[model samples]
Target: MSKRRIYWTLQIIGWSVLIMFEYVPYVLEYGFDWDNFYNALINIVLGIILTHTYRLVIRKWNWSSLPLPSLGFRVVVSALVLGLIMALINQPLDRHTLEQNLLDQPLVFWGYVLSWWKSLLAWMLSYTVYHYLEQTRLADYEKIMLTMSMREAEAKVLRSQLNPHFTFNALNSIRALVYEDPAKAQIGITQLSNILRNSLLADRRKTVDLQEELRTVEDYLELEKVRYEDRLQYKILADPHTVYWQVPPMMLQTLVENGIKHGVAKEMGGGFVELSSEIVDDVLLIIIRNSGRLTSTESTSSESGGVGLKNTAERLSVLYGKGASFRIFQEDEKTVRSEVRVPTMSENPVISAKEIRSF
Candidate 1:
């Protein structure tokens, strides 16, 4: 039996014995008697004894996965043992009560004991039913916890996939610049190399300092600038105090890339993209905004069109569940904005020299 089942079983048996032994004899004799008083004390002593017995049983069994037949056997065995002990104590007490001028014969003592045993059986059965329901509830709770863990693992895998996909695309952009403009290509390659090194290092960590992540985005933008020339313009603003905050690596970088691809890249007249961060209440808010017309085409990939945003949402869900926020919307006709809010981390000024080198 489960510990809970065994506990309640013993409780029911003890209480049933108490109620039956004390109340029934008083009614049979039609008056109060020493036997009634003696049985009450016997019940109290027996209750304590049985409680200790129950504890020993639980300790010895390790009954996490006990079967119904085993539980039934335990119930029967415990009742038998408890009844024998009660009977032994009852024998001497009954004789003492009669010798003290109490009119009770030894002939009916067995019958009286059987009456109380039947009551105890009824109580034990009722307790078993209640405990069965409680066990079901506990089983349900464990299943829910397991399901939630599986979902979190799946989200973590998807986030892992997204980081590599974004990196490959970024490297491809640098590769295109290599042949189109050799001088700019050399600088692009160098910037890509630095970004790649930092990305590889950050991959092993769940979070990196916001300053390091911003530096990577800056390098990525610099490489893009070489390709787009005057067609792309960008700026960054950050709250000085919040610069050392920790966030998932490449989180903001992905958002910035989305802004450039979907907004700035599509504009013929050229456009400005801005990245900014601030601490609002206890939250660190990062916003990426760009100038572009509001339109959606079927050809736009989910990564840039919607996939990247979905991936970002999934990562935030894994890292912070509902505590973090991500949003994309049109601020006005000529501007589109993506904003994220995550719990702010206390500044840690001395992360690592290698981390600082990324900046």
Candidate 2:
């Protein structure tokens, strides 16, 4: 039910119980007294209206934001005032007694205030618990929305970086082919078009299935192969069971571009590019191998230091923290390897994005 409806329902039930408790004793003691019933009805109605009005005032001033000690003092003062009002409202019922004057019997007057004070304090405690729980839930919901927005924004920046790097290299190859081979250049344009369309889709999503990322990478590699011709040979190996796991879009494509730019394309013989994916111990492991010698200045050089590797590292850290890792090093003099490992998680993953506000 809505909060407004719940508030009114509890209000009615609470006041109804208070009214019954007051009037039932009078009915049992003196067979049917309209005077006693009238006082009980009026007292209950005034108590409900006054307490609800006080509640509205507390909400208007946002008293819940106050420090614990200040809030407790305010609640006690309000309850004491409400209890005094209830004692005054029920005063006419005591006119026939020996201690008829509150001025003469001050102890009796304090006894009524003390009884009502306990009842009002209980109501205050109930309201405090409900208000605190509601504040906690609102805080959690805002946190989730903030995290989703940040991840979407970071993904966009990473894709933007990768797209230009891939396109510049592809267009460069196409420019050279135009004078040497017109027919192949035309085909390269078509492959580039197809790859860009897939990239546009990837740019719009935070994550896509592993199969979709692999397909986009294959399209990219196909465009590269048109330029490398007889020198570039590639192999892709993937476990069928790992196809549906979610991965950052275009991640593999960026890695493949990085490998070719630094490794295979620079080699004289232009050896094979090997890409593989496997699931081991609840981790999705991707290995990209290419033929090139590892050099000391590879990462430090401004010209060859493409944004792909750096973006990959940032994205992995943002998305999975300790659960993901990206590393690139030379396996041997003839072969350099880039390896990535991310937790093999299912769909509808709940990630705690609180610590990753840097992105």
Every model's TM-score: 0.63, 0.85
Assess the local accuracy of residue 107 in candidate 2 as a C-alpha lDDT between 0 and 100: 85
Error of 1 at 211 (Å): 1.2
The Cα local distance difference test for each model comes to 0.69, 0.77
Q: Looking at candidate 1, what is the lDDT of residue 235? A: 96
Q: On residues 1-359, what C-alpha lDDT tens digit does candidate 1 reach at each position?
A: 56657666766666766666667777687876786767766676675566456545643673323787887776666665566556556655565664543245554655555554565455444555455555565566556556565755755565565566557767777877766788977887787887777767654666788899899899888877766879999999988977888888777877787777778888898798899999888899999888875566312344354457777777777666677888888899999888899885422122222311100
**Tens-digit lDDT track of model 2 for 52-129:** 877787777877777879888988998899998888777765555535647688788888888888888787768865
- Model 2 TM: 0.85
Off by over 4 Å in 1: 1-81, 89-148, 176-186, 201-203, 297-306, 345-359
Which is the leading candidate under TM-score? 2
